[model samples]
Target: MRFKSLRKSNQVFIFAALLFAGLYYGAGLLVPLTFAVFFAALVLPVIYWLEKKTGIGKPFSSFLGTLLIFIGIGILLFFFVQQLGVFLQDIIESKDQIISYLRKVQLKAADVTGFSLQEQNKLLEESIMELLNMTQTYVSGILTGITGLVLNFLLVLILMFLVLLNRDKFEKFLMMYIKPERQEETKEVIQEARKVAYKYLWGRLQVMTILAALYLVLFTAYDLRHTGLLILFGALITIIPYIGPFISGTLPILFLIIFGGTVEEIISFTILIAIVQLIESYVLEPIIIGSEVEQSPLFIILAIILGGMLWGPAGFILFVPIFSMLKIVFDHTKGLEPVGYLLGNERPGSKENLMEKIKRKIGRKN
Candidate 1:
């Protein structure tokens, strides 16, 4: 009986490994729809809860919640556009001075690094133009994309409503396949998976808000070029996790240096970026994600890169959460529990470091 159980377990594990492998590769093909569905899952819960609490009915509450969401999105987009326009106008007004500053910075770079600044500028300009041109190439396709976007939006909204409306039915559908003894465990897993998604969305916003304020203050105090833009950049880009901080921080530093920054000023900027990321990674992410979440820096980086490689920047944003959700599911299953352990935050040190610090402080006081 023991051997039979062991063999069954091993067989289940093998099947799960193959299943996930297919899903991982299939993600490349399904990212757009997957992301739309992912966002739906995030938004639907609140809409569902509100409807239940107030007896507002599914149709009206969903309509109201979706209207509010769209309105909020419009406001944010409007605000972003207005800010960007003003920032660009300021940059244009300072174009002559900006050019002069960049020239000086270029000459300085040549002196320090023995490179041709003109060549570097030409390369940067060409790269930017090339990317823009590539986007322009997709202009005709963009019309089709917009149409698809609208269709997808409607689909997601409908799906969300249906999912919420039939939440119990969906649970029953899944639970039907499982043994009676394991039905409760299966339900618990679904609940926990949703919580992971919710935690990521909420916690990410909180972390981004903190970083945005810090970047805004730092840039404004220092009189950095395009301060408003940099702040917006910091706020938006940080959502991408591992690569976001570097990209957000790097562009500003590069721009500053290209406009003739002192080495000390450059160092200050670098240090600030470093400190912010250290706090974000070592302090904030750990605190917010807690023991319930398990992800490594390396895996996060890989996920982002693979996501980007597959589906541009949007892919980078979605990849971690999608994989994390899968990890949660895999961990809960008896056969794939070991694989979950491998993927999850099992490090004793990073979490323990915080406790040890507290321990040392108490010992000192005694």
Candidate 2:
């Protein structure tokens, strides 16, 4: 009996390990697919409301909603490219100003830090030349990237249509394996998953939009060059979590310093970024994320870190949903319920300091 039990335990462990590997590989391939599904969940209610109010069929409503998503994307892309073009033009126009600013900075740095202009100029020249070379190399890379993007876009569209067309069948398919006694629990998990996914995607979109718009207003107000482009970048990059903000913020600062803009303008841009991040973190984040996904604060931060460490930005975007699904599975299993509760997020503002926050996040159960 002991031998048999040990063998069974080993078999279970092996199966679980294999399952994890499969899931990780599958997730890498289906990040784009996951993105489409997340959006579909968000727009599902709208589709239903439209269908109910106007007598439209589900398929037709799905197509219309997909079209709306495409149209909004088209507009955002148009603005982004337009801004990029204008920013590049401004860069070229301000070439002389940039060189002058470099000379001033070089002089100031030498006075303060005892660096030599010749060395500074040599370093700067090498960097600029390297960037130019990199841009040329990126041309081919861009073509490949564009091809991948088009493929993913079509795939997302197809999935949205199929998911809508066979919604009832899909639900049945999901529940087919579960025992009759557990069907209700399975249904509840599915419902909760859908709600969390919807809240998350929509909340993220709304916050990103607000931050981007705020950037545009502040950049323009400060007379920063390429304000529109930087704003578009702000909107786009905030989708990537913590790292995105730093990058999008750096670009505008670069040209501001490059063009010898007033210290006032630079200061304004800095203040604006600091404020937007604060607002997003403290106000918008809690409001959108509050008690919804059932993820612990530590897990959420770990998701961001691991996503960044492993797969870069794509990981961060997909991390929360992936973990939420895992939590559902864990919740369903008898022995894993305690673990699931620990993996979930604790409420914020219930602590006085960082250590307290960590304790609350980690010490959820006795």
Candidate 3:
């Protein structure tokens, strides 16, 4: 029996590996669908509320919700373009300063490493030329693929609208496939998963908003060039988890250094970022996001890595909620509770065995 069980486990692992392979290779199609599903879930409450309040049908309400989301994205993109223009202008104006800073950095590096300045300059020029060639290739590829990218984006929007409109039908269809005895449990799992996803997405938006406001104030106070652009990009990039904030902070600091910021200014800004990160890690995340999904840190990190490997950036954004949904399903199912526990956050005193505690209570009664 033990051997048979082990064989079954191996089969399951093999199946999962195959599924992941498909996901990685089929990312072009799957990524947008994944995005649509998440988008549908995120805006579901708004759609329902609008339907209830306005007495409109689900189809109309879903369209309105999708439109609102599209408009919001459009506005953000508009501002991003404007800020990018300003950033480019600033870079152009500071070109000489940037070159001076680069030369100083090259010299400093040569001095520390005992390499001649000429050798250092030669290496730097080679690296820059390679980077420019890569950039040119990347730009051309993007130009060629722009049409398909737009079409895929539109398809995602359409899919999101359809999913929202037919959400009830989809739920019923899922229930129809399940055995009658398990239908209620399945429904409970579905509801729980939806609740977790909604809460997580909403909490993320709140966190991003607060962080952007803080960054804006801080950057403005420091008199940083292109403060608005930095804050927007930084806050959005922080959604990547872990290393994202460091990258975001480094970009602005590098820009400042290139454009003639003082050492004191650089040090002060770095210190300010550390302090803000402390507040975000300790206070804002706990209070605002809470423990809705309760995924273990190790598992979350693994998910981020796997997601990045499979779907690139979209995977990073989607994998946490995907894992959270899986956890909900595992928790609801009789045989998968162990898997759910493995994914869950560790809690103090939760290690006590429930059966042992029950036995102790019985002994006490005796």
Off by over 4 Å in 2: 1-17, 23-29, 88-96, 132-144, 305-312, 348-366
Off by over 4 Å in 3: 1-3, 85-93, 105-120, 123-149, 349-366
Candidate 1 lDDT tens digits, 113-157: 888887868865466556545644454354436556556556655
lDDT of 3 by residue, 151-205 (tens): 8778989988988878889999898899999898888888888898888888788
Residues 89-155, candidate 2: write the lDDT tens digits: 5555655666677788789888998878898888886787567456545644654466566677777
TM-score for every candidate vs. truth? 0.73, 0.83, 0.85
Once all C-alphas are superposed, what RMSD does model 2 give against the true structure? Answer: 5.9
Give each model's whole-structure lDDT.
Answer: 0.70, 0.73, 0.80
Let me know the TM-score candidate 2 reaches against the reference structure.
0.83
Model with the higher lDDT, candidate 1 or 2:
2
Question: Which residue pairs show backbone clashes in model 2?
Answer: 295-344, 295-345, 296-344, 296-345
| Best model per lDDT | 3
Worst 10 residues of 1 by lDDT: 135-144
